[model samples]
Target: MKVTWVWSIAALALVAAACGGGADIEVADAWGRPSPSVAANGAFYMVITNNTDSADHLVAASSPACAVAELHESMMNDGVMGMAPVGPAGIEIPANSQTTLKVGGLHVMCIDKQAEFVAGDTFSVTLEFENAGTVDVEAEIKEG
Candidate 1:
């Protein structure tokens, strides 16, 4: 009986290990373009790494530096390049994959700037994910 119980416990532990678990979402290379005080908007970029077994969504973003923060995308429309908001649904980060927020692509649009985002200036932005929760990222303003 003792032998059988020990074997059953070992099997359960192995199964648990194989199932794995959720991993924290990682934000890296956080940066933003320098904007003058007169400018009403700025752009932020970064790489989001999803290390979990399940996929996640970057549902929202916010910052104290701007009156409005939103996910935006740039694309060519009928031969004319145009930029637009990504909507409230937000962007997706696949499981075990990386999503990059870059210029001329997907990015965080900081509108109605409360201060100038000049070179060397830093600010914090909160990224809200569907499963990973909220993460605070410090973004530096500089030239890429």
Candidate 2:
């Protein structure tokens, strides 16, 4: 009986080890606009740090705060400002590197705002990744 119990414990430990002992990729300080203050649209920004020694990409994103969520980039086209969708070829996070989505840069544009996000309010957003799967994060609404 003692032998059986010891083997069971060892098996459990092995299983835990195989499952990485609950280790997961870390995300920090994720926040964004809950809704546009004056317009029907808004944008969100966050910093994503890839702790693992592997390359990853932000494939997709979604939020209940808006009718549509899309990855966008603001750029200058012959002195004209333009924004466009970044499709399946998503934002890349190099191994051991960090990427920041900020104003006038790569960001998630929330279109057709559904709810207003005031400062101190939190909203849920799901980010899809190539390897880490879907990570649901809360964004704190703040002044842009």
Candidate 3:
């Protein structure tokens, strides 16, 4: 009876660990807000931390609030600022490292807004990764 009980507990623990029972990657202070007035498109910023000792890449992103969702990076050319889509290569997050997606750098650009993103509201963005797979994160809208 004692041996059976121990096996049963071990089986339960294995099942729970396989079903995301362990600690997960932590994402905090994720904020996205519409650009100031006159800006047709807006950007989203967040910090992704990889707690595990495994590498990950953010490959794609999608949002219901915009007609088009893409990973973008800002650049300067001849004193003019421009934004362009990230190519096939995805953003890499090394093991035990944090990647910050911020303004004037790398961000998720929501184009052709379907509905205005308001502060204090939350929206979902699905992020596909190479190692970590797909992670759906709730982005809080805030005033930038």
Candidate 4:
């Protein structure tokens, strides 16, 4: 009887995790730019919310739509705005806070795009997190 009770508790825990009952990370507002047919580069933007007491980091990303996918930040230099690649550690999301990846800020830079991005098109981007493991998000291409 004790063995069965322990197994039931373990099964319930697995089910809760599978349903995101213990998930500390949440993604929303995932979007990307619709590049011209001749363009070879694209970008993605979104909001990442951390609800847990511990912080987390977005370590990496993968997508079939781009040859190189990485985090980047836009900065102003000498009155000119330019983009630079993020560090190996990637971006950080504080506990009980949210991170916004938007234009003129933090965004996912997709270089050497496999194909041109168009309106009404969607693509998958798998984001690797420090504690959340991997979460795949569907990014919608829209006019920016």
Candidate 5:
């Protein structure tokens, strides 16, 4: 009985260790707006949730559906709204928090799209992180 208990405890410890001590970043609710027929640019939005003890950065993004993908942030000056690139470092997600990429906020810019963005369409976007590595998520295109 004692030997069995010891082995059980050791197994549990190994399991916990395997799953702990890492930046756990998750992507959810990823969606994009349907682009106009003659538009070459599009945008993607989603929620990035970080559940780890340390902060992480979304370094990059890519998709075969677009010629280029970049992280961008919206800016407003004197009631004029504009946008700028978020740079190659990408957006940061603080420890144990969530960052949302919305229509007029932070978003993924798709340049020279390979196809038209139509409603009810889905595509894959691979996101690279500083700590969590790469994650590929399917993004749904909808009319906005």
Candidate 6:
């Protein structure tokens, strides 16, 4: 009887978590462009989808290949497009919505790349969220 009661409680907790829907995040279409060996920096792109009722923020990003990885944005200034690091608040992921990290927009800035981003190669990047915890994803090297 005690074992049955414990199992019942555990099942209830699982159901509650799924139905509550708090900070459930998923990453898809993660890819990075080819960077020459001499290049100092590279970028990664992906679609971050939030599948819950509560919103969350992507606080940071890191990888073994980059000395520094940061959330960055590209915007137009004086009729020319420039790239800069994102603010301290990081990137907002609205509830039940998705954000795209693409060229000419928000992306993961891989600074001082430790290795070449060659085509057909793969690397790992870890994304840290304010509430959803950390997600490890493989980034495929490709050309646009």
Number of the top lDDT candidate:
6
Across 2-104, the per-residue lDDT of candidate 4 in tens digits comes to 9999999999988976776455888888899888757878889999988788889998887988998988999899999998998888899999789999999
Task: Give candidate 1's error at residue 43 in angstroms.
Answer: 0.7
Q: Give the TM-score of candidate 4.
A: 0.81
Per-residue lDDT tens digits of candidate 1, residues 37-113?
89999989999999877889998889999899989999887999999988676898998899999988999899899
Write down the lDDT that model 2 would get: 0.80
Q: Model 2, range 52-142, lDDT digits (tens) per residue?
A: 6898999888999879989998988899988888767798877867888888788888888778667888878888888888988888887
Runs in model 1 lying further than 4 Å from the true structure: 1-23
Which regions in candidate 2 have their CA more than 4 angstroms from the true location?
A: 1-24, 33-38
lDDT (tens digit, per residue) of candidate 6 on 74-142: 999999999888889899999889999999999999999999999999889999998889999999999
Give the alpha-carbon lDDT of every model.
0.90, 0.80, 0.78, 0.88, 0.89, 0.92
Error of 5 at 111 (Å): 0.5
**Poorest 10 consecutive residues of model 2 by lDDT?**
19-28
lDDT of model number 4: 0.88
**For every candidate, C-alpha RMSD to the true structure in Å:** 5.6, 7.3, 6.5, 6.5, 5.0, 6.7
Residue 48 displacement (Å), model 6: 0.2
lDDT of 5 by residue, 46-127 (tens): 9998888888999899998789999999988899999999977789999989999998899989989999888899989999
Clashing pairs for model 2 are: none
Q: Find the number of clashing residue pairs for candidate 4.
A: 0
Clashing pairs in 4: none
Give the 10-residue window scoring lowest on summed lDDT in candidate 5.
Answer: 17-26
Candidate 5 overall lDDT versus native = 0.89
Best by TM-score: 6
Better of 2 and 6 by TM-score: 6
Question: What would the TM-score be for candidate 1 when compared with the true structure?
Answer: 0.82
